[model samples]
Target: MEFGEILRLSFAAIRGNKLRSLLTLLGIVIGVFSIIGVMTAVQVLQNGIESGLSNLGAHTFQIQKFPVMASQAEWLKARNRKNIDLRQAEYVASRMTHALYVGIESFDNGETVQALSGEKTNPNVTVFGENPEGISTNNWTIAEGRTITAADDRSGNRVVVLGKDVVSKVFPRGGAIGQEVKVDGVRFTVIGIFEPKGAALGGPNNNFVAIPLSTFMAYFGGNRRSLNIMIKAKGPEYYDDAVEEARFLLRTVRKVDPGKEDDFSIFSNDSMIATFNDFTKYVKLGVGFISFISLLAAGVGIMNIMLVSVTERIKEIGVRKAVGARKANILSQFLVEAIVLCQIGGVIGIFVGILAGNLAAMALELPPVFPYDWAALAVLICSIIGVIFGVYPAWKAANLDPIESLRYE
Candidate 1:
């Protein structure tokens, strides 16, 4: 038989048993959808996180009382560590030789900011208490006027730098600089507005307000609260050296015993990315295991359905063989039928999976991903499942005696 004749017969066979074929297709669809949907979403998050981690400027890292990435289970231990106060941070900064700039900062979230005109922002605004150096460490660029100067930080002056979100909400008018905005009932003179940083993994990057570190502590907490000491190296080559220098200085100043671990945690952008990757590894593994089981079950369903097809078509096979059809031709026809079934399911799964996966990206404001590699892999896997499960059924139909099959019901 010609290849076209075989394909036509294969599709005709599937169409003949629409309900059964659909049941088999359902298994394949579920398996492939599980794999593709989860993988595509994960890929999107990975891209967003890597970009978001870049919020920390190059050659910069932070030493804080808490780890950059930690679970709630470890929160109690982290909370128990002694606070890295401004006094201690200053002492370390005065001695750390490798760091070009050492800045101190702390923040409180879920506070409201209001303009003098009574225009107010949502209660979700994050207010950062930052030194002048800390402002630079945050990668905040001045779009208008100027950032808080060292003078503003020295005397706990209530000067502020507004993120784009704050400015939009509090000072919607053109003039934001020189306006006074109240942060948690404390008034601060807005000295500058930082260019919008867009959204990050956690949320909007430009939805915060920054005041001098001293002002933040004076009003929000106190000078004794834990501070994140931001450190910048002169270049990438000095990055490690700067961290080590800061660590040593902090330990010496904090009087941490030599044999005991330092109370502080230090992390850079590279380390943060590595931590995030480690977290995602388990997610992928769990997802892969689940998908594997689903696909395995789907493969079994394909084999069962193909065998049923062979049984129901006994007389047809007998007639074809009697009409001089070769065993190879019979085998090829049944095999094509099985393959067509899987491919149909695979195509549907891929389409639905992409749509479902990108829904998460839409929520996070991340760009959609095509996941070409995964789509191709899904297709290849479908073909493999078809071949692995269809072989026995096709071979059995091919080996049947023409006379016996014709005599049977």
Candidate 2:
């Protein structure tokens, strides 16, 4: 039999039972959509987070009471351990010879600020306490005026730096530089304005006001000790050694026995990424298993429909055999029909899946990413399903007895 004849018969069968074919394909479509859309969103979020972390500088790492990216319970447990105070930060700075800059940062609760420039009072800002090293440590750049000096930190000077949004909201006309703004009635001269550093893993960067750490600790009633210390290695090659040395120093300082785990957490961008990747591995595996189940069900449905088709078309098959059509021809035609149905379903599913995933990413305010590799795998699995499920029904139709089949009603 000619290939054209086989294709025509296969498509005719599909066209005749349009609703059943569509229902069978629905399972495959939903399964593929769920898997593809979820993974795409996950991949996009992962990339965005990694890129954000990368902007924090690979040469820098932080020593803190807790891991920066752990769950709440773990974070709380770490916090309950020995607090690494300002003295410890100073000690680490004094001891480490490989670090170029070591910074101590401590934050207090939100304080209200009233910007009074001839009754132009703006009162919505979160104030922080930082020093010269904090500027370089937090990847902040000054837009106007200079960052707070070590002299400012040492003398507990009441100088403040404004973020871009705070400057806009308070000054409006760029008149904030060298102006005095009062935080809880303690006046601070605005010595600088920070350049816009887009949102980080925490929140928008433009809504903060920074002052000297000494001033914040004295007037704002915070624990005078530092909760986090940041260290920048002198060079890229020295980063690993710096981290190891810092860990050893911290362990010795905290008095952790050699046989016991360290009391504090040392974290960097690499550590955070490793933690996130470990978490996502299990999630992706579960999604893969779920999608496979749905695809299997769809395949089974296709097989059942193909079997019904063979039973209903027995007389037609017998008539074709009586007219000298070979069993191979009959088998090939049915198998091709099943595969074509699945290929069409797979195509539709892939298109919808990609569209849904991208739309979801936009809705969630994350980057859009295509699951190209996973899509390819899904298509390959669909094709395999077609071949596996179509074989038995195709064989059943091919072996029909012409004499008995033709006489059946």
Candidate 3:
């Protein structure tokens, strides 16, 4: 028989039982959707994070009290470690010969900031206490006025640098440079405005205020307050040596035992990306396993549906056999029908999954990601599932006894 004839018969059989075919198709769609949706979302978040991390000035890294991303057990252990204070950070900063600049910073978050003129920001605004050197270390460019000076840090002056979002909210008419804004009810005169940095890791990046580290400790410091030290190397060639010098300086200042591990974490943009990737590995593994099981179950559903289709069409199969239709043609027809159903389901599943994942991207203000590799894999997997599950029913239909089938009630 011609391939066109076989295809026509296959489509006709599927059309004959619309409800059943649709129900069977759903299994495949669900299986594919689960895998594609989760992976696509993961990739989008990963892209956003990488983009954000890249903005951390070249040849720079931060020394913090704990890992940016850590498991519960790791966090618990880190919580017990001694906090790295302003004194300790400064000690490391002073002795690091390879470092070009070292920045001391700490933060308080979720503070409602109010402008003296009556405008205000939401409680989610992040307030950072950073030294003047942080302007370079953190890759912040001044858009207006002047940045924090060494005197600001030493005197604990109530000066603030506003991010673009904060500037827009408080000084909508544009003179933000010297405006007095209340940060969590404390009066701080705006000293500068920072260039806008877009959303990062699917969250707002420009909704922040920077104040001198000394003033920050005066208000927000407690027994648990810790400092993060950002260091920038003079050049790319000096980066590793600078980081090593900083590490040794910290170890010596903190008096860490020679045999013990360092209490703090040192990380750069590359390391941050690596840490995030490690976290996503578990997510991928778990979702991949669930998808595998779901696909197997979906394959079983396909087989069951095909078997029923073969049984219902026994008389028709007999008529075709008696009219000299070959067994190969009968087998091909059933197999093709099953494949067509799976392909349709797979296509629909891919479309829905991509749409669902990109919706999250849109909300995060990040660019959408199309995982072409996964889509191609889904198509291949669907074809394999069709062949694996459709073979038995096709064989059964092809082997029917024409004379007995013809006499069926």
| Winner by TM-score | 1
* C-alpha lDDT score of every prediction, in listed order: 0.87, 0.80, 0.88
Cα lDDT tens digits, model 3, 1-409, are 7889888887888889899999998988998898889889999999999878865789899999888778899888998888998778989888888888899888888988899889999898989888889777988889988999999988989999999999888888998877789999999999899999867774449999899988988887633588899999989999999988999999998999899998999999989888888899999899889987888898899999999988888999999999998899889999999888888789888889888988879988789989898899888889889999999999999999999889865
User: For model 1, how does the per-residue alpha-carbon lDDT over 175-263 read when each residue is reduced to its tens digit?
Assistant: 98888878899888888989888578985589998888888888998665788999989888998888888888889888999999878
- Model 3 earns a TM-score of 0.82
Cα-based TM-score, every candidate: 0.88, 0.83, 0.82
Q: Pick the candidate with the highest lDDT.
A: 3
RMSD of each: 2.8, 3.6, 3.7
Model 2 per-residue lDDT tens digits across residues 1-409: 7888888887888999999888887877877777887787678767766766753565899888777777888887876787787666677877987787777777654555557764333455667777578768778789989898999999999999988877777787777888888776889899999988745444544777888888877887646444677888989999989988888887877788999987888878888888888888888899889988988898898899999989999999999999998899889988988887787788788788888878866765666788889889878887788888998999999999999889978
lDDT pick, better of 1 and 2: 1
**Model 3 lDDT, residue 234, Cα:** 89
Candidate 1 pairs with clashing backbones = none
Worst 10 residues of 1 by lDDT: 196-205
- The reply for model 1, stretches above 4 Å from the true place, is 1-9, 97-100, 318-325, 402-409
